[model samples]
Target chain A: MISSIGRFIIGVFSSTGGVVILFLRTLYWVFIGPFQKKPVKLESVFYQMGFTGLRSVLIVFFVAIFTGIVLAMQTAYQLEKMGAVLYVASLVAISLCRELSPVLTALVVAGRVGSAISAELGTMKVTEQIEALEIMAINPVRFLVVPRFLALFFMLPCLTILGNLSGILGGFLVGVGSLNINPYLYLQTSFKYLELKDIYTGLTKSFVFAILIALVACFEGLNTTKGAEGVGRATTRTVVISFILIILADCVLTSIFYFSNM
Target chain B: MQRDYSQEAIISVRGVSKEFDGRKIIDNVSFDIYCGETFVIMGCSGSGKSTLLRLMTGAIKPTEGSIIIKGKDISKLRTYQLDELRKSFGMLFQYSALLDSLTVEDNVALPLREHTKLDEEIIKIIVKMKLSLVGLRGFEKYYPSQISGGMRKRVGLARAIALDPDIVFYDEPTSGLDPVVGGVIDKLIKDLSEKLLITSIVVTHDMQSVFRIADRVAMVHKGKLIQVGTPQEIKNSENPYIKQFINGLPQGPIDFFKEDIGILEEFI
Candidate 1:
């Protein structure tokens, strides 16, 4: 049992280490490659950001709102029996600000954006478009992955902020309307409990999660073997790996936050 | 052997060999492809013909020897340098390999967008001209999945000619087409080569295509070029392997099936 646990820990660290190495390599190539002197494909980047990021807003908003409402209902019902219903606002605010917003947004992005990245790139690799790019003296990583990585990196934090706001708004509606809590008091409590550190921590986690999703998806897509079967495998691996990494990073960040104050 | 009077050579391969997993695929292959000529590499299945093409195109490094493309040693070039060298050659794969997410115009414009400093308007014009060249002028908005195989091949041809590459590699360009479509593709290949004055290397077992399009045909057998001649010369050659291959005969140096007793008896 102990050996299995040790092996699991080692596996996680190694996978994360591999992702880190790929991220560093991507950054190195981005700065040093010849295309750095060329003007950025501003139009392409804007289109991709709109396609990959803006399209994701509806899903994130719905999930956050639903999660917040559900958590308020459950927490208010449970705490009311003990005359602690007022604390439900603090619970919802703290949870959404510190953990749920970033992690849930990542999960949603993994399902929506990460899968698309893997499939798009995997198909490109299969079709030899990547080879065509290389032959044309264009770096596939710069032409393809850099735009995607930048898109996710910039947008994940934005999404996380949107997610947190929507979640708190959902909690406010539930607390004031359904739970019969005062609106002004609920807002004051949520603000008092949710510190800047909590918001910063969640955004930091979101940024890391964004990097992890983009790196894993791009790496798997770039290295896809076999063909169509290989693409399906790469897509599955990207989502599963991203999901696990986001959750794990959330835990670590949460623990850091938990212990630092203690 | 006497050298045929023709245009100057653009690509020269000398003593090139490639091995995969300890198995020799292309061994001691040597040939020269001339400018503005349609050179066809013909061979039986599993005869290392495609491997030879890959080595010549710098898609894969040769295990031994060198391939010089227009006086540059491709094997000695660095990765980016190799990429720069490869810009001069266009490759059309057996599958059309059109990017599925991209429309036909975008697919055709990919090379221009990647390599040139041309404005979008000029790129679009060039793409239109290329598509019209391949007879795909109005299908610019369609994706690969939405098009038929022949249309896809036309789009592939359009993209192949996009950058006006000095050399074009067509790997079985007529493989999966009907004979009529295949003949049209053959005519297109011939016309395109003559019009652009570009070197073309077509790898196929299609005899009809060879006779229709090839300026010179080279037959590969057991990882060696057994014959390199004009189509007329190939037809008239008395080499047994060439005779057997061109005729599609089961007998001679090439085996059509295994000689296992049960299978042999069942066939009989």
Candidate 2:
């Protein structure tokens, strides 16, 4: 069992190392002489972002709202028993701004956009379309990856804001209407307790997560081997890696924030 | 039987070798594809036929040696240069790999729209002409999933010819088609090649298509191109591997049992 665990770790390291090397090579081509001059397909970028990010608004909105409501319900129940129902707003605000919003939004995006990126690029790789692009003097990285990376970089922040708004609205409905809290009091307390740093930190995490998700998805898709089976593996790996990375990043960022305060 | 040497070859592959992992798949293979000829690459499964096509097409680089397309060493071309070279040849994949999300017209129009400065109106005309050439004139809005495999292949052909490429590479064009459809595809390939005067490299094990359309057939065996000749010469060639493969004989130089041994051993 220990040996198997060691082998798995070694395998992951090698795989990651391979991906890094390929990514660097792609970057070199992207920045270098010939490839840089190739015309950027702006239409492809907008189309992909619209398909990957915009079309996913409903899913993210639904997930965020439900998460906020559930958090409010659970926290209000415990806090009310302790005669601290007013602290429920703080709990919802702090949690959403600090941890839940960014991480959950990333998870939702990974499920929606990450898989789509991997599958789209993977299928392109499988069908030799990527190769066809390369043969056409179009840099696959520029033609495929750059647009996606840019789309996700810009769109994830937008999704994060949307997620944050919907989550706050959900908590408001549950806490103010159902829990019979004073609307003015809930609003005042949430505003008072929530620091700008908390919101900034969440947004920063969303940015990093977006970059991570895009990199992993494009990397896996670009390097897809075998055929259909390879595509499936790439999609699975993108999601799993994005999920783990988001959590790890959240923990690290949280530590940084806490330590800075200390 | 010598091909005319005055006309410069469009694609010249010299001493190419490719290895996957540690195993050599394509070993020092060399060939020159002229501008207006149907060059058929024939080999049994796993004979590195497809790999050769990929190397020639610049899809994958040879580990050793070079591929020169139209006086440019494609293996040495920058990404953009290679892309320009790639535009010269349109490839039809074995599965007729039409993008499922795209309609037939969109798939056919993709290359023209991507690489050309032609207006959208002109692109549409080109798309229609190409599709009509392949007898898919009215199936513009149908997605790949909505079409039959044969229809998908025709759509793929239309896409391949959309840009009026100097060369077209068809990877096992008749692999999955019925005899009737396969013959139709072969005729289409022949007709298109003739009408457009485009050089074509078709990789296939389909013997009937080989006889029907190939101006010359190059038989690849165990990484080396064992023979290159006309269809008649290939039939008469005494190379045991060529004879066994072309005749589909179970016994002889090409061992079916040895191939099965690896799989059976894995199970055991």
Candidate 3:
């Protein structure tokens, strides 16, 4: 029994170590891969951007808007008791920019894009397509992982910015239409409480969260064993692990910004 | 044009062994494959024929001993060096391994595009030529999922031979095919080795494919080479395992039981 527990702990540590090595290798390729004789494909970068970013816009937008409404309505319900219902705008904006937009967007992307990445690469690994790539002398990391890393890194920030804006708009609609608050006063109050620092920190979190999702997904996918069942497991692990890591990272970054007053 | 199989060995494996989870898959195997010959490795399921092929191709490292390919010790080479050495090699996977996202032409064109500076026109011509070689001439725009299994295998062959490699490895070339389709593939393998003068290493359990295409055959039984000879010699082999395998017998040295389940227990 003790041996089994020891094996389990060793497995977890080794898996984590493998992921860190994969992450560092991917980062190295992302910077130096372009200078190689056969550079990483520019077209693949754009293709991943389309798949992971553009296709995700509508879903992210809708989720953000609804989250904003829920936040405003729930907070208004309480603020009314204190006769501070007009403060709903500041609450919604600050919450969206500081936490909801980045975290929720990452969670959604981790579910959609992260799982897709894992499934695709896992299928390739199982079917020997990755071996085929290696036999052809192409580095599968540069050929497969780098484009994905770049796509998420660049596009997640853009998605977060859009999500934040859509969320604020949703707050505006709920504040004026449902709560009967002044539109101009709500807008003024929203901007007054939401500073550039909030936007910067949120975008920064989104960027890091993007790297986390891509790295975890690619690592799980590349290390997939067995067959179809393994691919399914990898996809699930990508979403679950990405969610936990993103949330943990968000806590650390939020604390840093809080303590440093950035 | 006829070719000779008595040339110097192109690949030499010496006392190689591979283990997975302490289970021996390949054990102290040794052989030499000469240049410009279709060398077939024949074995029953779980005999490690596929694993041996992977080791030869440098896709997997052996646990002990050495595999020398074109005079370089494959196990000792760095990752990039192995990759550089792989430029001379091409492989057709058992399932074809065609990228589902790419069209037939693009799949065939991938290695050329990545490894060479040929003009797009030249690349298109070369892709067309390879497709023509594999009898996939007109299916260039179709995806892998859109093709029949035999056609997909041919497309895989086209992709594998796209770079005019000096050596090609075929893993179970006719495992899942009908007899007629398998015959066509067997004929293609023979013709390609002759026409291109490219060394061929085929891993299969198919007796007909071994007889039809192999200039030399290596019979593996439970991770050991029982015999290495021409097809006629293998057919004449008196070894019990070889006879059992080749004759398709129900009972012999090759046990059917996966585990030690008792006969009475199995029936119960």
Best by the DockQ measure:
3
DockQ, model 3, C-alpha based: 0.85
lDDT for position A140 in model 1:
76
Candidate 1 vs candidate 3: the DockQ winner is: 3
On residues A1-262, what C-alpha lDDT tens digit does candidate 1 reach at each position? 9999999999778866877777886786557654656444667778778977899999999999999999899999899999999888989988997889999999999889999999899989987878766655567777788888888989999999999989988998899999889999999888887788888988989999999899989988887888999999989999998898788878887788788972
Q: For candidate 1, give the lDDT of residue A1.
A: 100
Better-scoring candidate (TM-score), 1 or 2: 1
Give the clashing residue pairs of candidate 2, or none: A135-B83, A136-B83, A137-B83
Q: 2 or 3: which has the higher lDDT?
A: 3
Off by over 4 Å in 3: A1-4, B1-6, B258-268
Candidate 1: Cα lDDT at B88? 82
In candidate 1, position A213 carries an lDDT of: 90
For model 2 chain B, the run of ten residues with the poorest summed lDDT: B1-10
The residue-by-residue lDDT of candidate 3 on A2-38, one tens digit each, is: 9999999998899889888988888778777667655
Residue B74, model 3, lDDT: 98
Off by over 4 Å in 2: A1-7, A18-40, A73-84, A136-138, B1-6, B258-268
| Cα lDDT of model 2 by residue, A141-176, tens digit | 876787787788788878887888788878888989
lDDT tens readout by residue for model 3, B1-268: 2356577899999999999999999999999988898899999899999999999989899999999999999999998899889988989999999988899999999999998999999999999999888887889899999999999999888888888898999999998999999998998898899899889999999998888898888999889989998888889989998899999986788886634546758888
| DockQ agreement of candidate 2 with the native complex | 0.47
DockQ of each: 0.46, 0.47, 0.85
| Tens-digit lDDT track of model 2 for B215-256 | 888999888989888898999999989888888988898775
